[model samples]
Target: MSEHNTHIEEHRDDEASKLGMWLFIFTELLLFGGLFLVYSIFRLQYPANFHESSLELSVTIGVINTIALLFSSMTIAFAVTAVQKKNNKLALRMIGITLLMALVFLVNKYFEWGHKFEHGLYPGSDLMQLLERGHHLYFSLYFFMTGLHALHIIVGMILLIIVYFKVKNGSIHHEKYVFMENGALYWHLVDLIWIFLFPLLYLIS
Candidate 1:
């Protein structure tokens, strides 16, 4: 009877954990949704300038980052499945791949940002100060939105690392992987946001 009660309590806790994660994700969505609405309003207000500014972005780097995040999403999903299947080694390998892809994405972003910095295209540079109103607004939104997404990427990576170590130590395994599941959900959210960002910030040109 005690063992059965413990099982019931564990299930409840897992359910509660999942619900909490969903709530957090919902809040994140609301935040980004607001940002997206603002972006759309400005994009409509300065269509030509938005297009011109977006042309300055390297589509090659944007596509590469997109692919990296997509691949990472796949690997993380695989990791979750591996854990559920009780294949700890496979789970670890998948998580490693996911982390590597995330690193690739961030590294590419670093170089891309550096390139913009070299050209004095960032938010506070004299070049930006001299730009037209539309151009200035475009760059501002570009930096703010992508920078915010990059922050989320770092947070997602931290969550994945925690999940990795937990899985390694057997704290998150087949029978109890709520943490891993939640981490993957967060990672996917990161990727999804980038999906929206890529076209809006890069391909619109």
Candidate 2:
């Protein structure tokens, strides 16, 4: 009877934790949705300017980042699967890979942003120079929106690191894997955001 009581308590705790994570995720979506609405309104107001600004972006770099995020998403999915199967070693390795990929994506973003700065194309900086030459409002939105998304990726990586340690120490097992699953879900959302950002910012031309 005591063992059954303990099991019930554990299940209750797990469900509560999962609920909290989902709530947190919902809030994040709303925040990002607000930004998306702003972008849409601005794009409609200045369609030509936005298109011209987007031309300054490096499609090649954007493609590379997309591929990296996709690979990281795959790694996280496999990590969750490994944990479900009770394969701790494999799960650890998968998490490590995902972290590395996230780092690579950030590094690429650093260079991309640096290049923009060198060319005098950042938000609210030398706007006259770009606008006088041609339309640049699109590029302004591009940098701000995508830059915010990159920040989210960094935050997601930090969460993944925490989950990695928990799984390594047996805090996350098949019976108590909600934390890992939620973490993976968040990471996938980050990847999904980038997927949409890439096409909208790069390929729409």
Candidate 3:
């Protein structure tokens, strides 16, 4: 092989990698899109139930979590920018802050779920047995969708942690920061999903 061909083989395409991440993100959107469609149909079937069920949800906590996730999304974006600017320390700090925000989100979710359980609102509970079909379905969907989103948040947090250490070790730097970009993209998707979820589950009226 020619020396030029060998050199080209050694370097990867960052734009191509980003395109791959975008494609993956689309698949995720489609998956959630189906769930949202189902939720909409059910709401139409039981308009009053959905509205009342949404009222049971703590709007104050939901709004707080929304703000936290949105802020974390910005932090991760800034971290990626710092990497592009060759400021690895700032990138690490940004990632740290983003991770803390994720922790806060999870803590809030724990308490929120706990409160529901205390009220016997979880799936298959005695209270669930007493509720009408529409009311029962509301709590069921609420648990299923939010549970999946929290799982995504956990995955995003793990990705951010890995990227933070990689940046600290100089593996992800200005000229080669595609991994950081991918991590940021995933985090943004997590936040975006929650943006849709908050209103769907909390403000249905």
C-alpha lDDT score of every prediction, in listed order: 0.92, 0.83, 0.93
* Best first by TM-score, ranked: 3, 1, 2
Q: Candidate 3: deviation at residue 172, Å? A: 0.6
- Candidate 3 — worst ten consecutive residues by lDDT sum? 1-10
Ranking by lDDT: 3, 1, 2
lDDT (10s digit) by residue, model 1, range 34-101: 99999999889989999888888889999999999999999999999999899999999999999999
lDDT of model number 2: 0.83
Candidate 2 pairs with clashing backbones: 50-138
Residue lDDT tens for model 3, 115-145: 9999888989999999998899899999999
TM-score for each predicted model, relative to the true structure:
0.94, 0.87, 0.94
TM-score of 1: 0.94
Regions more than 4 Å wrong, model 3: 1-9
lDDT of candidate 2 over 74-120, digit per residue (tens): 99999999998989899999999999999999999999999878877
Score residue 12 of candidate 2 by CA lDDT: 49
Question: Model 1: which residue pairs collide?
Answer: none
